[model samples]
Target chain A: MALITCQNAAFAYEGNTAVSNLNFAVHRGDYLCIVGENGSGKSTLIKGLLGLKVPQSGSVWMGDGLQPNKIGYLPQQTAAQKDFPASAYEVILSGRLGTRGILPFYSRVDKKIAEKNIKRLDIGNLRGRCYRELSGGQQQRVLLARALCAAEKMLLLDEPVAGLDPVVTRELYRLIEKINHETNITVIMVSHDIHSAVKYASHILHLQNTQVFFGKTKDYVQSEVGNRFLGITRRQESGGEAGGGEGSD
Target chain B: MIDILLEMFSYTFLVRAVIVGLLVSLCAALLGVSLVLKRYSMIGDGLSHVGFGTLAVATAMNASPLTVSIPVVVMAAFMLLRISENSKIKGDAAIALISTSSLAIGVVVISITTGMNTDVCNYMFGSILAMSKSDVILSIVLAIVVLILFVIFYNKIFAVTFDETFAQATGVKTGLYNMLIAFLTAITIVLGMRMMGALLISSLIIFPALTSMRVCKKFKSVTICSACVSVLCFFSGVVISYLQATPTGASVVIVNIIAFLLFWTANSIIRRGYA
Candidate 1:
């Protein structure tokens, strides 16, 4: 069964329609990459998926018999977030909040799981440090750890590595790969990095405002529709394009 | 001074006022961190103005301020939340609109009711000297409710405050928590009226959080430090008011400013030395 389904979904902010006739299905253990230009309704779709913005028409259905706590998310980071006064540990611990309900305290088991995840990220030493004091990459890692705290089966990352050096970007992708491969968790990440998507994702979703293309990564590379949607000249040699093409780096 | 202190101890109302002030200090510090972090530092200011209007209207109607103000401010809170969610009016602007309008209505209502003869100095500027027994009890109860909510929703609140979209993606119900924060803020504003008053209440909700950020590098430490600063400042303000016969709200705000300046100066010096 599909873990998340958006069927004929439509969303509007006031009178302006942001998304219309959107349809998608996300199964477990699939690494799907959503690629789009800015204001292509990508964030709006994600918001709908997360149940933040209710659809004006159609429905979004998370699979039945699954706990709500199984979903995890990493939002786009802003410069202002650096000055927020939360510790990395505390931020990560918040992931457990969904599963713990609205209770007054964290259980010992919850603490243990959170600690284990923190140590796994190898940022145990920095756990007690303020989230704001850390470098951007470190803060992102801490946020990733926090996302993992509650996310058991699926992870949704929204432009996780939007602004970073090449080395840090690769390292961050590696961490995400490890989580996906080792845990067999379904991963849906939105990125402008076509190269990285080619490297990591099995499935591709290209969105341009009302336009959308969904298929296997290889299929997207070969198909006429995919080529037009992606606005890329396909290379037959590697079934993917050449090095560091526009916005991919 | 000893005689005044003794006199204060003798009155149950005074004792209750002190206790209520202490409790509210903790609440202010706790919520202050997130408010400042969100950069919506004017929430307290906006909401308090709404509370002031509600109080004035209630007084004009010859109704109980506490009872009337709660629903009025709570409704205003919902309106603020709805307007902000529209993505048309910016958050600060929406807050400003509601704040100024309600205050204007309040001023008009008060003028009409009392023919502009009644003294509302205590409500405008804050006077711990005038706190009644019922006011003290109400503040205490409200403070406790705010504290309990914080303890329960600490994680969720932190996530939403830090990055709202991320919290929603994680299945954390960001909208619900957002409404919860606004609701609690309304209650805090109404309860804050007696001690902090309309003019200076925002300072109590903002300064402690900023001071904590200056000295503490960690989130947990910031929260702890903010709470301590709030409690300490409340009593010191009370004492200063006693000694100088100044307004209690102004005294507390002065204390907060001193702490903020001191902490900022010390932080800059330390950073400079290291550099």
Candidate 2:
């Protein structure tokens, strides 16, 4: 059985349907990138998957022993996170909160997992440092490690490289790719960076309020929708192609 | 100084006020860290206004003010949360709407019934003598409960405040924790109103946390520092008020402001050292 099945799922926002007719099945070890322009309902879909919002007309079913709390998520940064008075380790340790239902303290196991994630992400040096004090790339890495603490089977990231410079952006994408490959953890990333999305994702799920395309990466690139969107991305990114050819493995 | 302190504690009203004020400020400081970080510091001001309105109605009805104000202020907090979440009213606008409306209602109610009496003035601006024996007992018991609850749920509250979306995605039930924070805040505001005044109760919530955050880089340190700062400020504020014959709430706020300035200066100095 698929890990998650969204059968005609729709989410209402401000009395209007933000997104609808989402029909997708995420299987084990799938590197699915959700790509769309801003306001294209990618975030709504992520919320739906996280069980934060109930679908209007359909259901999002979790199967293959997957639960809502088990999915690791790295949401976009909020204003509260800026100048937040928490150490990077504390933020990362909080990811174990999913497994800590009703428990007041972080267990020894939880702490060990946090430590392991820190080591895994090579962020042990920043463990005790304040989160807000870290640079943007470092902060993203810390948050990614935090998401890793909760993600046993799958990782859900919403625009993880949104504000990062190209060098850092490429680094983060490759790191995510490495995680997906090494751990065989299924990855569902929402992004508008179509070039990197095509380069790293095994599958592409494009949205313009509804599914414009959902298939393997190669097929998506050949499809008319993919051709148009990639063309726009290429044109927009024409001047900055320094590391463009290197991502293709 | 010790003789003055002894003489000061000799008065029963001062002792009662000191005890209640310490506990209330402690609770306020603890909740303030999360509230300030979440940008809901205004919620304290808003709920204190609701507290004023309820106290006004309670006084007019010849009822126990604490009992009347506590639940009403809590409900108002929930309503404010709901309005911000579901309605077109954003957080600041919603708080402003509720706060101004409540203040107006309180003023109107007081003018119609009590005609600006000493009790009304005490509730509005705070008086040390306003901490009656029964109110002290109630405030202490409630403050202890608030402290215990806050300690037990500290981890969850930290997660929720720092990142509600991530916490909710982790299945932390952010709504419940948000409500929990609001509820505790309401209880603190209502309890502190008679001695800290509805007009000044929010300072007890905001100032200590902000001052501590200026110096402390971590949440645990910030919370600990804020608690100590608020408690120390409250004690000294009360003592100063007694010695100089000033209003309790205003003195405390002034002390907090001074502490904030000192800590901010120290923070800048420390950062410069690092640089």
Candidate 3:
């Protein structure tokens, strides 16, 4: 069964439509990357998926015990949020808040899960360090671990590599790929990097204001929208063309 | 100096002032960390002005100032939150509008009714003998309640203060917690205004948090150090005021300023040592 289904969904902010006529399903173990232009409602769609904003029209359904609150999320960071005075361990442990369920304090199992994710992300040494003092790559790793602690089945990331160096971005992509393939966890990511989206994601959801194209990556690479987005023609099979075609879509 | 200090504590009003001052200082410090981090430190100043307005009206009506002021300031706090969130009026603008208007109302009301009496002066500038026995009891109970609630919700408050969007995405009820902080702040401002004065109570909320932030890197340490610093400053300020005939509120603010400078200098030295 599909883990989540959205049928003819629409999202709006203050009665102004941001994205409309969205129909999609997230299957178990699927890696879906959402690609779009600026103001294309990628963040609004993620808000709808996370139940942060109610659908303006139609319906969003969750199945296979996949509730909205259970999905892990890694939000785009800002300068003010980066200056928050917290240790890496505290930041990651806070992700278990939904699971704790009105317990007032974290349980031992929550600590263990936090520790496991810290080890998984290879940030055990940085756990005791302040989050604001860490490098950009380390901070992203800490946030990723926090998201991992919340994910029982799926993870949702919003522009996770927005401001990172190329080397760090590549390392993060490998880490996310490892989690998706090894743990069979579903990955839904919003990205501006079209090349990495095509390289890493199994499925693609392309949004251009009200128009959307959701399909398999290979099928998307062959479609008109994908070809225009990826800057590829019917006869071209070269990978070098994928590099500069990032922000076009 | 010791004899003067011992004799000052022997007075009932002086003892009440110290007790209430320390409790208010602790509550202010505890709530200050989140307020400073969230950039809502000015809300304390805004609410204190509202409290001053309510207190002036309450005094004119012969009503208990605490009873009238607490609910009114809490409602104003909620209103400030709504205006900042839902309307085009930004947070600082909204605070300035409401605070200055309420302060004007308070000045007009006091002038119309009391006409610059010592009673009005006590609320504006804070006298050491301003807290009554009933005020002390009320402050102790309410301050304890605020402290307990803060401790219970420490982690949630930390999460909300750090990344409100992520906290809301994880179903942490950011709105409710924001309201909780505002409500507690309202209570703290109302309680502290009696001892720290309407003009100086916000310093009680801002100074300790900022002072601790200079030296502490973690939220927990900042909170702990803030509380300790607030209480110690309040005690020394009260004693200094008693000994040197300084104004209570100004003495407390001065001591807080000195503590902040000391902490900043010491932190720089420590950082240089590590470097």
State the DockQ of every prediction: 0.52, 0.84, 0.65
Instruction: State which candidate has the highest DockQ.
Output: 2
Docking class of 1: medium
Which scores better on lDDT, 1 or 3?
3
Candidate 1 clashing pairs?
none
| Model 2 interface CAPRI class | high
* 1 or 3, greater by TM-score: 3
Give the TM-scores of the predictions, in the order they appear: 0.88, 0.96, 0.95
lDDT, candidate 3, B1-275, per-residue tens: 78987899889999998988898899999999999898888888999999999999998888999999999999999988777666566778889999999989988888898887887778888888778888989999999999899989998998888888788888899899999999999999998897788989999999999999888878899899999999999999998998889999999999999999999999899999999
Query: Which residue ranges in model 1 land beyond 4 Å of their true spot?
Result: A1-28, A52-69, A78-80, A210-212, A228-249, B1-13
Q: State each model's CA lDDT, in order.
A: 0.78, 0.90, 0.88
Clash count for each candidate, listed in order shown: 0, 0, 0
* Tens-digit per-residue lDDT, B1-275, candidate 2: 89989999999998999999999999999999999998888889999989999989998999999989998999999988787666465778878998999889988899999797787788788988877889989998999999999999999999998888899999998899999999999999999988889899999999999999998988999999999999999998988988899998999999999999999999999999999
True interface contacts retained by model 3 = 0.56
DockQ (0 to 1) for model 3: 0.65
Weakest ten-residue segment in model 1 chain B by summed lDDT: B115-124
